[model samples]
Target: MKIAFVINQTHKEKAGFTTTLLAYSALQRGHSVYYIGLADFVYLDHDKIAAHARIIRQIGNIADTQQLIDALKSTSKERVFMDDFDVLWLRFDPVLDMINRPWAAAMGLQFAQLAQKLGVRVLNDPRALVDAENKLYLENFPEEIRPRTIVTRSYDDVKQFFEEQHHEIILKPLKGSGGKNVFLVNKQESKNLKQIVEVICRDGYLIAQEYLPKAQYGDIRFFLLNGKPLIRNGKYASVHRVQSTGEIRSNIHQGAKAQKAVISPEMLQMVEKVAEKLIQDGMYFVGLDIIDDKIMEINVFSPGALLQASELNGEDYAAAIIEDLEKSNGKNKTE
Candidate 1:
């Protein structure tokens, strides 16, 4: 299988990232793997989609993800046609480029959509990704699993939601990740409410959600593939991230510690609630952030933590994902 991973940038990727693991796993399986940055794509005349991709060469000699990262950085990018790839995996964080290269993520998606139309499999369906680009996408799911939330660029709207939620609310960029600019506000600390809203809205809109008290204990980062729990050897691919002292964000990169997740019946039920829509949207891979009984976020674009989940659960989730893709593509060919 020839798979191309579209990421924010090759230089910005780390060895511990889920994208690295997937690419390394594909290489270990003797499949061709390529890394494409958001700005790497080129559109030729006659509707051909191509990219100057960093091809992971000599996969046999590369030992692990660090080596893969090194190769990706050291190797010069070579032009490759997108249609030649068996899978064009959109693994980039849209918010990463939203500031400096506002056009990068959208252009990447546009190229992915073109690639999909040309019969190349694109994961997480580009069309769906367009609408799912921001936190508002969570509204598309059943309200039962989501927290009381409001999206606005107005400080007054945020203030209203804060008052409605009894002066406790979580505010963050409507389109963001990695816990950047996330703020937890309460009645006693409402002094900075207006300022926070102003800062967050500078980029775009801000999401104000009823603060779940359970968030003090951190949240679960659960992995789902094809809208189902990614399980291996009776263990689900998930990690319970414990936030640092006095911190509200449980993002792994935001000083959160990863531990084995204790999957509950209620969590599985929540999965069932969102699974159908995810499958229908062609979100082949996703990550859900759960606090208590409500889902705080649905990460369709580059839902990470698979590596940490694998380490904690003693599972090979990357291999499982690659194997599933291989089988699915094989079945498609046979059909």
Candidate 2:
């Protein structure tokens, strides 16, 4: 099967990224792989979607991640139609390009939605992604599984939420990621609360969430493929990300350390409820940010960290994922 991963940028993608891991894993299984940057897509007449993508041909002994990275780095890109591939995996981070490339992520999804119309399997359903344009989508889920939250652009509204939450809240951009522009504010002592809200709201809405005390210990990054916990040999495809001391964000890029995760019954229950709806909505691969029993975020577009999860569990989780994709050809293909 031919699979193409839509990424933020070709040069920005590192060897350790989950996109690289999944792409490499697909290649190792002798499947044709392609990497298309967000800006590389082309829409043709007659309702066709195409792109200039870097194709990963099975080069000599491409056995590991590093070798695969080297192979990708050395290869050049070529024009390819989405109809030629079995899967158009949306692995690009929408928030990463929200500033400079504000139009990039949206355009990529627009093309993916077009591709889906052409019978291409667009993972995590591009149409559903349009509804999940930002963090507010979590509000659509079961209220019990999410933290008390409010979205606002006004400073007074944010201040009200802060005070209502007993003077403690986590503030961030509704559309932001990678732990960027996230701030934990205590109303009594926070001098920059106004400025934080101003900065976050400059781009879009500001999300004020009740700061979970468990956040100090970090959150778990749980991977769900096809609306279920991705597991191999009884080990879940998940990782516990412990934040650096004094940090509130548990994102790995923000210096959080990854460790083996414990899948609690509460977590499973929450996942089951969320997955049932997600599967119906076409969210094929997802990552849930779990802090205590509340879900901090639902990562549908470019949900990652499967590599860390695989390593922490000592399991070949990627292999299982690629194999599943192979065996379920028309299962996930969008009409």
lDDT measured at residue 177 in model 1 versus the true structure, 0 to 100: 90
Best by lDDT: 1
Which 10 consecutive residues of model 1 have the lowest summed lDDT? 326-335
Give lDDT tens digits, candidate 2, residues 225-273: 8999998999889999999988888889889999988888888988888
RMSD of each: 1.9, 2.5
State model 2's lDDT.
0.86
lDDT of 1 by residue, 1-335 (tens): 78899999988999999999998988887787899999899989546889999886448678889988988899999999888888999999999888889999999999999999899999989999999999999999999999999888988888888889998999999899999999999977799999988899888889999988888888999989999999999999999999999888898888999988899998899889999999999999999999889998999989889989999988899999988998888833211
Tell how far residue 292 is off in model 1, in angstroms: 1.1
Alpha-carbon runs more than 4 Å astray in model 1 = 331-335
Minimal lDDT window, size 10, model 2:
326-335
Off by over 4 Å in 2: 330-335
Clash count for candidate 1 is 0
